[model samples]
Target: MGVIGLLMRPSELMALVKLKKQIGVWKRRSAAQEKDADWEFCFDMLNKVSRSFAIVIEQLGDELRNAICVFYLVLRGLDTVEDDMAIDNATKARLLLSFHDMIEEEGWDLHYGYKDEKVLLEEFDRVVRAYRSLKPQYRATIKDITRRMAEGMQKFTEMEVTKIADYDLYCHYVAGLVGIGLSQLFSGSGLEDQGIAQDEALSNHMGLFLQKTNIIRDFLEDHEDYNEETDTRRVFWPKQIWGKYTDKLENFTFGKNQEQAVACLNHMVTDALRHLPYSIEYLSNISDEQNFLFCAIPQVMAAHTLALCYANPDVFKGKIRKNLGECRNTHPVKIRKGLSAKLMLETTDMQATLSILEDAIDSLADKISPTDPSARETIEKVQLCRDLIVQGRRSSSPSSKVASTWRQETSKATSYVAEQCTVPLLVLLFGITAAVDVPQALGSAWWQSEAVPAKLGPVHVWLTSLALAFYSLTLLLLTRGAALSWCKALSAAQVAMTAAEVVFSPVVGLSVVVQALPKLLLAAMLPSCAKQRHSRQLFAKQQAAMGNRRVLRPRPIKADKSY
Candidate 1:
């Protein structure tokens, strides 16, 4: 079965079908008459090395597609060298620094690496030949990036990365350069704005975001077994971040430290997400639809992967890749729509933009039944986006607008106080019921004369006391944010107290039922309260995990008169 075959959802299946159809069209159009054996070999290598990328690369127009295929293979060869630990440090460093120069050397290749990548290294002459066949500008761009990346890899291979900056530098060398190179290719192909190609900061962020995600996701695999001979692990997580959490990077994966591990993972995800706005900006600037998709597929996949990694303990246990079906099924286009809505809101009237967003969300719900879990999540995220916009607008206004904000805050405070007091109110009611029943149970003439059972006095007192104790305990648990199981148990005890009252005295039983109703309702709501508490705890943990790192809260858009 293909990757998409793993837990295939209907929507995802449809998306995969559409993607395949698009790929088919590109393949048909790019089909060469009397195909060159060298070009064919390059594509074959792409499929073998990275099938996922092959799908996207194949969708490119003929010229750009071929260029990218060769570019990918060249980088794959370079990466193979960096990954192969068996190569002596001296040889690896030398080859890396000179690898770019060898592109024009004819018949240049490396034979030593992991089994899967070794073939690419050995057949790299074909990649270099294809590179040479590209236009001079494309060739120069590829060579420039390759040379710089090789040097960076050489430096890191020989030294330890003890700081976050060093880690970013290493990522820049390995992946950031690829982003720069691709931008140059896009610009050289006359498909994207030339200015975008020169925006190194944006390009660097694009690469760093992707590289950090890969490093974070592959933490377990990368640190599994250090080179036994060298007693060193192949890790990209900056010591600056992980060192604060644990003495050994591997400890984060331990069962006892899973919480810390998840926090650390969330922190890394947050760092990666910082680049999202720039990435969105990059996408917005792209004019070529196919090129945009080409760039978009990976960015969307990165976001989906980060979501999977968030608070996921299994990431430390082993590999946790999204199934092909799941990856294919993700609605990245919806995310793009969300970004557009945000941009529009920032540049248009707030109320008008929000109305448009609401309509879009409703339309989305109509198409994908709100009953669907995915649809619900999407709707929730979009609504959150809308709320964020409203909050931004409110926060940005002058002092005259402060009155409305104060009113909203006051109302929220009132609701919060009311919610918090429910348990205490239940406790008070339980105490009152117990007190009231004592007088009745003591055979007070007025109470006993009304059809009271002759033998019910002690039983009434016992039931009331038991209920009082149960309600007090339930209140304690609710205040402590105890599990739902405990709340249910307390509820069961209340039910028993009601049953005893009913059997002994109908009037008292009716009164007990009325008094116990609120407690029962509160018990029922505890589960939801527990859920909210859990969410708050998770958020707190995430913040703690981030430590001194500034969390990226979305900023409000300034209203534009342009609606």
Candidate 2:
């Protein structure tokens, strides 16, 4: 509990408090009374094996909860056997393939395994007894999935995976199968649509998303066996990806190849994001509120884990995890919004990367100003690293080179005058367009005629002025590389300006479009600029590598905010 308290973020602490209250209410419910001795023992094993999952599982209704509980224990036992490197390859393979068959036999248990999971392994017979007590449909679904999963694990045990496709296949066996099994149970309990269970692709993505994230997060531990002397290392990273970055997977952990390691990590995170849509769809299809929550909690954690692991060098040095407070505080809504924003930015590619770096700097600066001296130093160092990266990117750009050439050709005061005049020149152009439109409308026969439209009276002048003001503000923000909120507001204002034009007169609309096109074009160029900046940064780093120079690694920052 003390270790948990230390690891938990403040938000996770609050979440734990709320969870305890909920569990108390659950204890008073009929669901708690229905638990038998075997079920209680099985649940205790679940807690020991996975405390986080146990919290979500406890919130479920009795029949479904017990079914999932048994399902988890059965898989846990099988995983224990697969993970025990002490077991010979042939023997382990045989046991995995036949593992499902053992569940039907009364009092069947395997105690030889990892010390932490030994309790569940030794007492697995009780889990089998509990499984037998489940309704026929639940038993059938769990048994089928267990058999398929065991078969898949057996296949992988016989050989090492060398390709990305094979890695995905291996993940499918261990995790995707669990997703399918859960969907079956959800359908069997009449809590979700039966169609959901049948959608193998969706179920597979849901499982693969979490599985890939875990694999990436565990790179430091999984790269080598606990005993380096006589044990073969367990290499789960697909050769296809890592091979591109390094000659050997182990090299990624070395300081010299830190950049490559981060690249590999980012590549993996991007791959995991591809499955997000399917995962969201699966969660959305679950109609029950409790069921939806049970499914969502893990997805949110996975999303946050990806975000933390993205640029952080800790993935290579050691295991990285979200604090319990952070994990508990993350909600499905927040994850969904983040995913949406991320996807939008991703579509713009390089521009989005630059935008993200810019945002990171501002965020770090805010934290640096209020922190203790030691913390401030760390924040400042990270900010400096980011600034260097940004500068490197700018130096590599053709536009930057052109600007440098122009500055070299002109005197400092002349260059300054040219820079100062550009904004005023554009504003004057827009102001003239506005001034011309008002007079043209006033002088037109449509304006002087008695039958002038009410919607197109003197109010048109006010709308035109308001639109001009918004357009000018948008242009100013775009020039300054504004925040995302300003960009969103600019987009909304553009819509309003267009709408106001339609309400005013055709001439007014035409004048607005004429003035707005350049601003719109400039707004569109921001992402391209960002993309170019990132490209230049990567190119500069590559050139340094070619010159046999060691590139400086970005220092890790201790920021309070989760990804």
Candidate 3:
């Protein structure tokens, strides 16, 4: 129905043609992978649940293709139970808590209420059959994530999303876990670098970004989703946010509070935008083309969805906004068929994707109101996205063939040098902060060597104490796997203090200046810590995910893997 309305526009019509061709290719690719009745049913269920995900899932290698298909279905089945209002809270909670085990039980089935989901759940044994056929590592990854997610869902089922932190944790459980599970599957398949799986924090952002967009865009639908018998509405919009806009969540849907509502909506959109840079970094690290597209297409689509939803009134309207004239509904909040198709075509082209992302960032920035409480935050996040886009544009440029070749070669060698130096450099910073056998800068030099005992001045001692305090706080919050902003601020302050010591310490000689240079370069290098969201959460988050247990030390892969 939406596609029929979109056909009037020439560009959309062209996009539709291209989209059809792509589907044809995917279908041809899928035919070879389909085995028997059980697999066919699973694939059929995949299509019904998500055409976008199923198409990409089918294009994967034979072994991986089955594992991912089963993984997605298991997660989707869990989600269906969570979303189905027909189930009583007790029943839902019980089901969610045990969903991980249910996948292995061939007799497990339930009537989840949604038409498509009813079929998926009722015939879930087929999915279980397919899942058992997967590699043991793949099955382990799927089971571990499903267990964690189900526990999370059951927990959240009993609470309201009252705070932004609550909202993030909820999103982490439902969506972020999907990202982590996929990464585990990817690495377990040996199709991607182990670092990709090890970087659970990065994976979490990718899912959060997409999940938050869905939460924001479906505002009207989720808002209106009331169950009279249970006397509950499945509202995921955090009260900490919506409470400031209007006294009631449904007030956003009314005309009287439209002004305040749009501000609230823009605030949510901006919060989602904060995750974009991390998503880009995760996608940039994908080495396989199919894997890249599998992640990239949906990510690009989410960015466009945010572009369409930014301060748009239709989000509060109770319908899918359709594209009719110039594929016009893109602005009205529904990501249209043609535009998604066009975005898929552009996913492989970094510059094209950046242009789309830049447009989305512009859409978000242009709507920031000075009067809104979150206006400054929205502006800052928007600018961050733009900055990253600018960097992407520069990197994707191909005009200088000679320079590009030289850069690739130099980057290879420089990358190796960085690999060897990185650990020792980190150790030096830790050693200095720890007051381990190391020289303290006297604010005028690395140390006054003339002093026989080298007892430090109060200023030097204080600076060391301050840096140590910052390190301790940063590490502590990192251990808790919370307070991302705190992590960034502390890390940034630590870097700045190091820089101050390097610059303020008098360059007593060329030897002194030379000694300070690496510290200065290390300071410069650590900006990525500030630039990337959840930088400290990489190990800490994985630690927390593994039941607050310690993480295994990662074996280093090639430092300069391709985007």
Question: Relative to the true structure, how large is the alpha-carbon lDDT of every model?
Answer: 0.63, 0.62, 0.71
lDDT of each residue in 376-412, candidate 2, tens digit only: 2333344454554444345445865455446444534
Task: Give the per-residue lDDT digits (tens) of candidate 3, residues 1-563.
Answer: 56544643456678878878987887778787648898899988999988889977877777588888999999999988888776888889889988888887786788774667779999898999988888899999999999999999998888989998899899999999899999988888788999999988889888999999999987776756666687888789998888878889777773447888888888898889878988877876787777877888888889889977876777876543322200112233567777777777766645556666775675455445456677667666766677776565455546633444464467556645643454456566666556531354443344445532355556556667776665555445544544343533454465567656554443346655665566555543332332232333443443343353332332222212111
Per-model TM-score versus the true fold: 0.60, 0.57, 0.68
| Model 3 regions lying over 4 Å from their true place | 1-8, 319-332, 394-563
The total number of steric clashes, by the backbone 3 Å criterion, in model 3 comes to: 0
Worst 10 residues of 1 by lDDT: 324-333
User: Candidate 2, which segments miss by more than 4 Å at Cα?
Assistant: 1-13, 27-31, 226-231, 254-256, 319-563
Between prediction 2 and prediction 3, the one with superior TM-score is 3
Top-lDDT structure, candidate number: 3
- 263-329: candidate 1 lDDT, tens digit per residue: 5665665556555445544655567867866776676556545555655666777432333111111
**Evaluation by TM-score, superior candidate among 1 and 3:** 3
